[model samples]
Target chain A: MKGGLFTSGYGPILIVVVALAVLPFGFSANTTLNFLGFVLIVTLAAQGWNLLAGYGGQFSFGHAAFFGMGAYGIALAQVRFGLNPWLALPLAIALGALTGTILGYLSFRARLRGSYFALVTLAFAEVFRILANASTFTGGAAGVLIPLRIDAANFQFADKRSFYWLALSFVAFVLLLTHWIARSRFGAYLVAVRENEDAARALGVDALAVKLKAITLSGGITAAAGCLYAQKFLYIDANLAFGPWISVEALLAPIIGGIGTVFGPLAGAVLLLGLGEITKTFFTWLLGGAVPGIDLVVFGVLLILCVAFAPRGVLGVLRRILPAFRGGRA
Target chain B: MGVRARAILSHGSMMLKFDIFLSALANGLLTGAVYALIALGLTLIYGVLHIINFAHGATLTLAMFAVFVAHQAFGLDPYIAVFILTPLFFVLGYALQRAVITPASHGDDGNILLVTLGISIIIENALLAIFRSDTRSIDVPYGFSVMEVGPLFLSTPKVIAFVATLAVAGLLWLLLARSDTGKAIRAVAKEKTGAALCGIDVAHIYAVTFGIGTACLAIAACLLMPTFLVNPRVGNAFVLVAFTIVVLGGMGSIGGALAGGLIIGVVESLSGLYFGESLGQIGIFLIFLVVLLFRPTGLFGAKA
Candidate 1:
């Protein structure tokens, strides 16, 4: 609709990024920094998921395929061939995009959509997880650990706050890109395909190609999250890298925050992780003992409640109430 | 010769290999019966509701835990526990759909998916919180008992499960074919709005279908407890395998699910026999992908 960044919706995103970028400075505690770093990484992954599922209408339950690709690709590049993490990062993201292309190609060729598409993607992820677990190329069940080198060149920072900044920068860039996509022709085409594939095809939208591009971009973004994850934790096994947990996390954040919005993933990630910590602490106090799954239980209940009462997610709710508070139109 | 010597001798003989192959086939069929039982509920739910219930696995895990608790706390036999838990779960399943899933999802497919996923998360984690993730199994008197058939010996529990599965399947078929409730369910599944126009209660039918599906899980759990372990996450493995079976049998086809389960079981067994144990698990998922890509309608499913 518009050429310039401000008209295309990047202005507000820039403000949000600037605000988030300064968060680590206010909290020197490693716990807070670590929490914020994780939130940023999850936000990036959720944004990737939202790009396809939220915007493009392709609900992939197997995003772990791309996430694991980025994770293992970068890890192997470093651990197996001794490459710098910085160089390996792009390679890993590319590998993730390539995987998205391949997975998208086969499933779309079959014209699988909706639940069928979701099931197939899930099966594909399980295949990857099984292969990774059984094969030595991924270090088998024992997993891989990156050598600790506390230098900026290695993408490993001596201070945790620096890593938080690095993660925040990546998330900020992705948020801008997402805003741009939302304003572009391709995004319109993607949404059109999502709304009604046959109708979109009738309008000559090339639904398959649009979906393919969306998935590729989505995969690359999610994989960037995976790459950062490997660099942060310095260790990943098949279960950790290719697990259903990350897939769930990637989907849950955007759904909770506000699907199909640029800032939804970020807001959703912060709320979800923050909710998790609060729930865990509250449950432990109430129960007089630490319970491991209380937080997840709360997440599940919250997810259901969100779907039932606030299907549009937190941002949607905020938008509804904000106008009332300001005595203005929504 | 002793059983070990016979096994060693059989390893060198073609006849013995054939015998082993037959035995593996038999084992697969037996295991497939339980798998079919698991998929039976999933396919039924899909057939009527037209939504993939992501909570299927967590429900199974819950049923298995029911069996475990019954056996541990009450000294109830798994078979007896099945009769008790089946009705209990029927009510639970009905309440879940009518009270939670229906009202919350507002009948949107995407919302239904997320709601079920959330329900799964709640159930699975609740089990984890309560049980502490310990893998538990019940010891039946027939646990180690085997029955000799020709040149092979089959586990008693497995044979019993096979018989029980067939009986349950037959009962389910008869109920659907003859009962008024079955007619209503079929009518609703065939055309929801039309069925509603015809004065059939679509919501009630949906709940009933879900109840039956969940009841099947109770039966499957009871049968499996004698041979399988129960843990917070144990149902997830079955859930995937059941999805494969439901797809293979064609969604919404009861008979097809049964046949698909047996076929998957044999394929899994043969592949495990040939390939290493861990990698052999890939055979099921690969088949799932191939079928989804090539034959999404499945062997007996109506064309989408």
Candidate 2:
């Protein structure tokens, strides 16, 4: 907010934003938009993880709990309470933040750190999954389905491009928020906490406050993605909402792209999900039968290579190679 | 009270309920003993490497599949497959440590977690590619034999699994306490620099320690084959409980892992009976959360 909108810090972002805005006109079928929409939504979730794990110094292994909360929040709202989907968006994200607050409050208040925090978050997600599977309010394991009334008020769209544009807007909002937060005073405090908690506390940083805020924001963002996911699929289930695979997907993108950077999750989600689809299609064509989760193996190998060869990530490697691009604070 | 909560409270009020509780207890102990073996290896690996190997679950699953494949393809008994797989896995672990894990062990904890997790994904998916996703089970002739204990009956597979686990644990204990290589591994885990000063091959020891850790899973795989089915993702069912046991028993304590295993076993059994099968995970997680928050060092952790 302090700097000019087209400052050096946002050169690449401006290009991407302009391109995405004009992208729909180039393609008539909405195929590219739908694919990119999926990428953007997942990128949104990945950014949330980047904020918490990469910047906030809290590694949450259960972000799916909030993603699920967002999904279930909207599904339950529309199905159980007969609320409009438009009215449900904010509530879903709020529910996500609320979930984050609970997870953060319990773990952070206990002063749990590192693996302890990770494990607790994982446990929390597991519990949520079980509850979703068991509780009638959640429709049990059968999951909740949205009513097939495609009204604009209900956030349903006649054209796939409308949903794509909406998803793009959400992605842009998160990217801008993350850009501002990455340079804010609180963001500095978060970086300090992540670099060294004891040292950060010694330097008068409120470690707990920073972590709580980061986690809350992270949860809300992830939940927002869940809402979009539900909208795109028009259905929600326990596995889709609260599965470990969701958590893994959210985290994997940011880690592979360039953690802690605003564009990292965006690039990562594209690379991972985009590449995954391409490879799956190619392999499926080559072998004539689906290789049964071949994409996971490829992605797994990529993850291993990234950690081993580029532990700092593709952005980190790029920054190292181009000193002029290096803008302080990893 | 909620139906689930009430079910939890009334685990054993009637004759049938009492009988069920007793049977669950028996089942828990037998499974818990085997769980002890799994936890022991995990704890030992973490103790030495100072890294929680995320690929361990995948490795366990791979070992289980090895036995399953050997049995299905060649008609070898599960117990006999143990002799073949144990050494095979050790070599694999050793090679993996030297080639893959060692390079990534550059002081950053997150890298290890991700790399091992990546390995786990690779292993799981590779298995899925090969075997499809269908569950595979082995048939043992004596697997169903039940022994009478007054009014209680214990199945042969469970008893054999329990005895085998205890025997393995006793052997591991003696090895760690008495053998020179085992002591060297312990010394390295306790004090890496000090062990190096005493002329210990640090890297070699690390690799061997990893091998031993993986070898333990081989035993677990074979022993578990009689009672459980194997699938690409079967390791997930047991891995979380194994992790909880490792944390509960203190990071590297053998006795603590054993105790933790038994506790989890009972918890799983009782919770499964009380709360329909799926909700039992909630109980395990709650216990893990409590243990984590209250005592970060764990029950049997050495005083820091």
**Largest lDDT belongs to which candidate?**
1
User: Which 10-residue window in model 1 chain B sums to the lowest lDDT?
Assistant: B3-12
Tens digit per residue, CA lDDT, model 2, A123-231: 7887788889889999998898887877677798888788888988988888878887887899899999999999999999988888999999999999999999998
**DockQ per candidate, 2 decimals:** 0.85, 0.61
Regions more than 4 Å wrong, model 1: A1-8, A324-330, B1-12
| Candidate 2: regions farther than 4 A off | A1-8, A320-330, B1-17, B301-304
The 10-residue segment with the lowest total lDDT in model 1 chain A: A321-330
lDDT (Cα, 0-100) at A307 in candidate 1: 91
Candidate 1, position A304, lDDT = 94
Top DockQ prediction, candidate number = 1
Quote the positional error of residue A306 for candidate 1 in Å.
Answer: 0.9
DockQ, 0 to 1 scale, candidate 1 = 0.85
Taking all chains together, the TM-score of candidate 1 against the true structure is 0.97
TM-score of chain B of each: 0.96, 0.92
